[model samples]
Target chain A: MKKLILALSTAAILSVASGAAQAATKVCFLYVGSKTDGGWTQAHDIGRQELENHFGDKVETVFLENVPEGPDAERAIERFARSGCELIFTTSFGFMEPTLKVAKKFPDVKFEHATGYKTEENVTSYNSRFYEGRYIQGKIAGMMSEAGVAGYIGSFPIPEVVQGINSFLLGAQSVNPDFAIKVVWVNSWFDAGKEADAAKALIDQGVDIITQHTDSTGPMQVASERGIKAFGQASDMIEAGPKTQLTAIVDTWGAYYIKRTQALMDGTWTTQSTWDGIVDGILQMAPYTNMPDDVKQAAMDTEAKIVSGELKPFTGPITKQDGTEWLKAGEVADDGTLLGLNFYIKGVDDQLPQ
Target chain B: MTLAEAILLTITTAATPLLLAAIGELVVERSGVLNLGVEGMIVMGAVVAFAAAQLTGSAYLGALFGMAAGCLFSLLFAFLTLTLVANQVATGLALTILGLGLSGMIGESFVGQRGVQLEEIAIPVLSSIPLIGNLLFNQDLIFYISIFSVFGVSWFLFKTRLGLQLRAIGDSHGSAHALGISVIKTRYLAVMFGGACAGLAGAQLSLVYTPQWVENMSAGRGWIALALVVFASWRPLRVLAGAYLFGAVTIGQLHAQALGFGIPSQFLSALPYLATIVVLVIISRNRRLTLMNTPASLGQSFVPDR
Candidate 1:
């Protein structure tokens, strides 16, 4: 009698476990920095939460935050795959090759890579068009800058950052042809102290408005403390700088996350390259504040134009930094040129670090 | 204020944290203990300070809590290395790993939160003096503590009897033990002091430096502080100078980049470490001084034979 009862209980527990597993799709994520870094990784984390909210019991979300790039990333991805994660997301450009390698090892486990080009049969790539917002920020900076010069704190000289610089300059030039910008590269994506120091240096060097491509809100806080105008990135930083933030380019990835998770659960997930923009609800601008009414209206108009396909930020009668003509009048740059963008436009003051 | 004045003010802010941490580590090393967990202690302090300030609505209380947290954290290291006779190097490294992970967990809630900035305390009249006035006389509370700590540490190391006893213990712990000196007790006090200084430095980071709580906000500054002690040849005054030199170079490189100097950003970013070490190395080339200041029994585990 005892043996029969024990066996029956064991069978029941196993059935429940299997039922739970079959009911919920396990989705895992690997991040390059802390989930609360207030920048790139933080943005992804917010999106992850959206996945949980949208799917409820249909999906289970797990994440390994602060996972470094390279070999460790491979181990982390493989660990997730081995643990029966049906879908995995590797966020960061450096995770590209590792994601591919791990995806190959676990073909059954679907993978998504953020901000990369390569996509395998089981791996997909997606990124937001952040430069679209940069163009708006530059226009705002151009209009409001009292000194006619702006300080730009860039994280790295990657094509993404380069595109921001060029697009910003073009937008600023549209407002005031002679408006100039000084660029300072802090190298790392998020070191608050260094980013703050960069902001101070730019201000002391005579730039009235400050903007940063770095992950931390350090620069924004500095601009606030110094009583200067600035913009936020990745996430809304109005809390950090109530009076200082002109407008921020916020990465609102919740909509995309819900869409993807729904598709995954519906058995319609497919590998694709996605570079969504403001129109797709993937990227958005924080409310225009700390600016004149006309400037705010102008910014909104610019946003409308970009979203309506009336203004392409990279279109140009633009000159390279060396005074050589790259694009003739009204020549819109292809995605290929923008992806490989490394050169500075004509009026940028700082040299690009190779 | 002129741009130069602003730059000078920033230099002080940058250097104060390093100076505070290095001076404390110098004492620890002087007492025969090599606590490499300065980074760990500092990060814990930053998170703790930020959290306390957020809770209490007072940055001062947060700073006090931060220092206490660091001191208590070091006691764990002291117990393992001094009492349990664990390898000091291994234990110290472990302490750092533990501190980083623990602080990350503790600071999880504080992440993305803006910290209360420790406002500058301007000295009446003195702050108005040309050039040096704003840089020295007007600054945050931690800056004053950092300067006083340097003077206090230098005077204590050279003039005080207890300081001599501690140095004797560092040089030859067994000999100090034979003389009936409580080597473990002195080392504990020294280690705790070092931890407190590192904590205060961290408080400065979260309160005065960037005024925010992020995981690993120290960003290797503790390791840099550890190096500063060696670069200063364990001299308190030189540590002050070394810290400033590093801070100046770090700020200078940023200015240079803004000026469109065209230097490679990576090389420019590394300029602080290179410049600080080179200057300190050149000044401390006198091997006798460096050798004399270094504790002979540093990093050695002490087992008392009662």
Candidate 2:
């Protein structure tokens, strides 16, 4: 009688285990850099961590980091598909073409690309409207600056960087009419020395405030040492320099990552574009300790207004860097104009690099 | 500082890494062995240096490890060129590919982890000297070392008996062999020196220059270094000038865009590379000039029997 009871319990456990195995959901993440870089990949890794936290044993996750953004990316996606990944996320702009190529071959697999524009039946794209936060930070830079000169450590000459710079200038000029943003393009996304040197050169030229789109906190460290103020690029770099860091444009991919993974597990996954901004809470302001109270209060008010759709930072009366009227006063720019922003506004010191 | 001053500063820093590597390659080529694996060696050095620095928290030790790693990889080239007597160009190409793959694999863990950066050791009055002062002396120790190496190499090649012998071997291995100069030994020394220099360049990249290792971060700098050697016409001082010129080209692009002073950004971005090609064209304009300095035994099979 004892043997029979034990045998029955073992059989039941095995059946349950089999059922759970069959119900498991698998997800894959492809990264262009190491997750530890504290840059693009780190943010993506945070999102992946959220997926794992929310789903627990219901979902399985794997990632391939430091994959090149071109042909290699497509190969990585194909590998994931062959390895039974139910969903794959390719994170990088250059991965767009490769992601689409792999998506077509793996129709059964769901694909979500970060910072890409392509979409397919099984593929979707999502990117933060980071410029929204840049515009806000620009407002702060304008208000707090004793020097009219603001140094911008630019990463690339891509459309994304262009958009951010333009939005930043527009926001700054709205507050400080005399503000001039002197940009220094390092042309690399993650070179600390180059970023630091660019910041120093700007400071050498009498610019007191700085901002960077580069990944490393070396620039912030330099700024702190030089007794100048600066804003963080992608992540909150307060730890890198608490004194100099006025604020940061934080990329909070966790909520969206968790939400999307859960959707996949629940069988509600669908291709879609996500252009969330301050309203949806994906882009948030890091705690503003260095900012003055008045400046802080103004930023808070602007944030609230932006979230409520009551304020449009890129409103008209905009003129190009070359003095061309881009928008009449009170004229709001459509999504298309902003999407294809090919020029800078007035008061920008450098022309857009070809 | 004017735009020119800013551009000059950027160029000097940018050329530091390339100049170190090219000088090493110059020595290697002078010995009549072409080691095309500089890119690979550089990557290996960077990854090894970064990993060592991260573990020990010592930038100096990290640099040593990088040089050691580069030397270790150079043995493959030496073995192939010296013992097996393989085709120099092909062996060098294989070395580059191998170094790239191996370094990429090893660099995976070191990626994104910041290593310690080199501090500038500036001389008092030298660093304070006007425009030229900031542009030249205010740089880190590596820059001074690179400049010193140009004179060092010039003296070694012209004033010293050993330098004369090395040049003789490069000019004609047969005649040098007849004079009883150990062909294999001289070649090995040159290659090893080249390897060490490549390692230093890699160390500078991860330690002083960037302070981080990204996969394949050498990013064709090695190829450009090779071109600089050709542009320098195998002269050390000229190589320095070529490197600085390339550096200026690179920084000039960014400066034009930064001050948004009015040039098309993309065109500016491509200017440095275009400038390199143009310079190469001009250097080769007089076919006789290249023919005069071209090593007679370059890329040639140097078998004792031949």
Candidate 3:
């Protein structure tokens, strides 16, 4: 009787699992921070939601939040792949190697790593052109800054972050030739305390405008408290600094998520390195707020020109830290060079960490 | 404020939390009880403080509630390690792990909400003075409590009879026990004090430090405070200097990076740890200094004799 009962329960479980598997594709995500971190991870989680919304009953989305980026990430990714997840997304740059390692084990499962460089047949690298929005922020900072100086709190000196610093200065320089920006790397992407201190340090040094590449609203709140203008990153931080936030670079990955998940469902999923930009709708700017009408109009004009392919943020008349010309006038920086950007452009008041 | 004054003020702000938590841990360690759960207690304090402040609209009330939560949380550790006669180190570690996980859940809804920051209280004449005035006199309530606690702790540990008894108990609980000091009772109070201080420190993090609750927002600061207790060799005065030094190095590196000093940021980011290693090595080299302040029975569980 006991053996018969056990057999029946096993068959029941197996049937339910198999039935559910056929009904919906299991898409899993690994987050480096909590889904409610109010910054980077939160933005990615929002994108994850788009898959469920767009695919509806065809897709069953699940995520493991606050997965540390190391061997732990490898375990989490492998666990998801083993559990019949057709696709997995590792949403952190540090999870690059881990994702690759796990992808090798699960040859059939597709993997997507955000802001990572390495890729394999099963693994793909995907990120948005966040620097495009930084350009608009710089332009607005140039027009609206009370000190003619802005502060940038960076999170590591990766090519992506360096690109943001360079693009912002370039945009600011376009409007105000004498504009200077200070860069402070908090090292880690999060840690609200360190981010706040970095912002305070810059403000004390006379920067009237503040921006951050780190995943926290700490800098924005600091700017708000100090009565200085600031820009938000990853998500709309108008809630964090309702009046102080001039605008924000909202990372809209939903469209890309929908497209990629749809490809997987359509059986056309090929490993592709995607670096979408403003025109691709992978990222966008939060509404320009707390800035003058002229600055807002100017920012919109720059965004329009970028979308129209008339203005490139990495265009010529730019110089490296050593005063070497990076781009000749009217020369737009190639995607390859920008993707591997390791040097800081001139007017940036911080040394590039190699 | 001038640049120097501003930097100094920032350093003071940075050091206050470390000072408070470390000082509290110092008392607990002095009573021969090692509670590794300082991180856990501090985080709970942070979450509770933020939640209270958000709900009550009073940062002070929030701070009080946070401190109480930290104190209450510490009692869990106290009951297990002190009363249950469980392994102190294991219990302490469990407390921390429990604190981190529990605070994350408690603070889940509070995430993304801007917290009510504890406003600075400027002393009239003192705040008006040049340089040091604004740096020291004009600060948040937490800063005042932290600075005052260091002095109060220093006096309590050295100048008072109960302080000496606590030290005696730390050095030789059995001997103090024979002499009629309630070993368990003293340790209990010491642990509670430690918990309260850690809680207050956490309150500082949410209310005065960053002004919001981030999950694990204590951010290993409680662990730093633990290291600081050892770094100071269990001395109250040294903890002050040590915490401020750590704070100074941390803020100084950021300033250097901001100023584009041509130094690599990875190297700048490691400055505080490097300074800590260097200071610790120097302090350890002085055997007499370490021997004088080291708690003899620290981490050893004591069962009171009937």
Candidate with the greatest DockQ versus the true structure: 3
Against the reference, the lDDT scores of all candidates come to: 0.91, 0.81, 0.90
RMSD of 1: 1.7
lDDT of candidate 3 over B179-232, digit per residue (tens) = 998888888899988999999999998988788888888888988999999999
Model 2 alpha-carbon miss at residue B25, Å? 0.7
Q: Cα miss at A114, model 2 (Å)?
A: 2.4
Could you report the DockQ of all the candidates, in the order they appear? 0.78, 0.30, 0.84
Better of 2 and 3 by lDDT: 3
Residue A328 error for model 2, in Å? 4.9
Q: Residue B204's C-alpha lDDT in candidate 1?
A: 93
Task: Assess candidate 1 and give its lDDT.
Answer: 0.91
Model 2 earns a TM-score of: 0.87
Task: Compose the digit string of candidate 1's lDDT tens values, residues A231-311.
Answer: 998989998899999989998877887888778889899999999999999999999999999999999999999999999
lDDT of 1 by residue, B167-210 (tens): 99999999999999999999999999999999999999999999
Model 2: residue A123 alpha-carbon error in angstroms: 2.2
Q: Judge the docking of candidate 1 as incorrect, acceptable, medium or high.
A: medium
Ranking by lDDT: 1, 3, 2
Q: Write the per-residue lDDT of candidate 2 for residues B215-272, one digit (tens) a residue.
A: 6667677887887888888889999988888887776555555555666655665777
Cα-based TM-score, every candidate = 0.97, 0.87, 0.96
